[model samples]
Target: MYKLICIDLDGTLLDTRQRVSTKNREAIRKALDQGIEVAIVSGRPNCFTIRIMNQISGRMGHITFNGAYYRIANKTRQFPIPKEAVMKVAKLAQKYHVRTYFKNKNLSLCTKSDPGILDYDQFKSQTPLKDQMDMLYNVDVVDVLSNQDINILKIFAWDENLENVRKMREELKEIEGINLYLYDENFEMSSEDTSKGKAIQNVCADLGIQLDEVVCIGDNYNDLSMFEVAGLSVAMENAPRKIKEMVDKVTLTNDESGVAYAIENFVLKENE
Candidate 1:
C-alpha cells in the first residue's frame, strides 16, 4: 500500500493560474485523512516552498532547492554543492552578464542588474503578492556569494533568449561535479548528487518507508527524479509526452485538478 505522496508544486499541484485548485485542495485533505503523508518537492527556494506547504494540512514534508535541502516540518537539513562548483557558476554568470540567483537554507542572493528594479516582470507574473513581498525582504545582496562561505545550495540563471539559455546549459554541462537543469525560462545549477530523487530517498529513510510504498506526481522535466523513485509515478495530462511515457498513469491537467483526480482515484479509492 502506498503510504507517502510526493507532489511538485509549480506544475503538478498549482494550475496554470499559479494557484491551487479547490478540487486539488480537497483531494489532498482526503489523502491525509487516509493516513498518506504528502510531501512537496520543488526546485523553488525554501521561502516559496514553505508558503506552499503552509496551505496544506496534515502529515507533510518538503524538499527545497531541487533536493539540496530537505524539511520535514520543524526539522530541516541542507545538502550543499561543492564550493568550487558554486564559484565556477558564479564567475561564469558574472562574466556573461547572466541574471543569476543563489539559494541557501537561510538566505537567497541575486545579482543586481537594475538597481531600481529587481523583480523581473515575467518571473513575478503569477506569484502571490505576499510571497513577492516576503522574497523582497529576505533576498540578500549578491556580494555575499563571492565569498563562497555561505552554504550555497542552488544557483539559477535567467535569460530572455531561450536559445541562449539552452546554449549556456550545454556549456555548463561540461563543468564537472555540477548538475544543470534548463526550464522554459531559467537554468538551475546544483550538486550532481542533489535532486528530487535523492531528497525522496532521504525522506523515505527518515519516515521508515520503502520506495515501493511511495507515489509521486509532477508535470516537468525537473520532476523526473522523483518519478524515477516512486512506485506509482503520475504525470499530468498537460505534461509532455515523454513525462507521460515514463509514469505508470496519466491524470488530468493541473487546471483540470489532476492532482485531485490522482489522489481520489488512484490513492484514496484504490486504498479503500
Candidate 2:
C-alpha cells in the first residue's frame, strides 16, 4: 500500500491554464480522505507552491525550490546553497546578461534588464490581485549580489539564446557546491545534496513512511529523481517520449486530468 503520492505541478497536476482541474482536485481530496499523503514536488518557489496548494486544500505538503526546501504544515526542512556559491552564481548570471530569479524559503527576487520593467510583477499578474499583493510583499527586483541577507536556496536563469544557456550551464557545472539542471533555454541551481528524490526521502522519514511505499507522478526531466526513488512512477501522455518510456505507466495528458486518471485507476482502484 502506498503511503504518499508526490505530484508535480506545472505539467502534471495543473493544466495549460495553470489551474488544477475539478477532477484532479477531487481525486486529491479523495486520496487525502483515504489516508494517503500527497505532496507537491516542483521547481517553483515556496510562496507560489503554497498558493497553488491552498486552492486544493489548506493543509498540504510541498517539496519546493526543486527540493531545496521541504515543508508539511509546521514541519520543514531546508537545503540552502552556500553563500559563497550563491554569490558566484549571481555574478555569473549578471555577466551572462541572462534574466534570473533567486528564491529562498520565504522570499523571491529577480533581475531585470530595465529598472522600469519588473519581470516579477508581470509574472505575478497572472495570479489574483489579492494573491499578487501577498506575493509582491515577498518578491522584489534587486541587485542580487548586494543583498546581504539573500539566503537563496535556488537560482533559475534563462536567455533566449540556447548557446548562452548551454555555456552558462557548463560553467555552473564546475561550481562545487551546487547542482545544475539544464532545460531547453533555462537552467536551475540548488544545493548539491538537494533533489526531489532526497526531499521525498526526508519527508518519508519524518512521517515514518518508507520509500518503497511512495508513488510519484510527473511529466518532465526534473521529475526524474522522484521516479528513481518512487515505488510506482507515472508519466503524463503529454510528457516527452523519453519520460514516458522511463515511467511504469503513462496516463492521460494534463488537459485531460491525467493525475486524477492515474490515482483513480492505479491507486484508488488497487486500494479498493
Model 1: per-residue lDDT, tens digit, 86-162? 77776666555566777676545665453433333333444445334222322333455554477778877786656
The alpha-carbon deviation from the true structure for residue 2 of candidate 1, after best TM-score superposition, in angstroms, is: 1.0
Residue 119 lDDT (model 2): 35
User: How displaced is residue 256 in candidate 1, in Å?
Assistant: 1.6
TM-score of each: 0.83, 0.85
Top lDDT hit: 2
Model 1 lDDT at residue 190 = 84
Best by TM-score: 2
Backbone clash pairs for candidate 1 read none
Residues 82-175 of candidate 2: C-alpha lDDT, one tens digit per residue: 8888877767766666667676664556654424332344445445443342212223334534656657788877766677667767778778
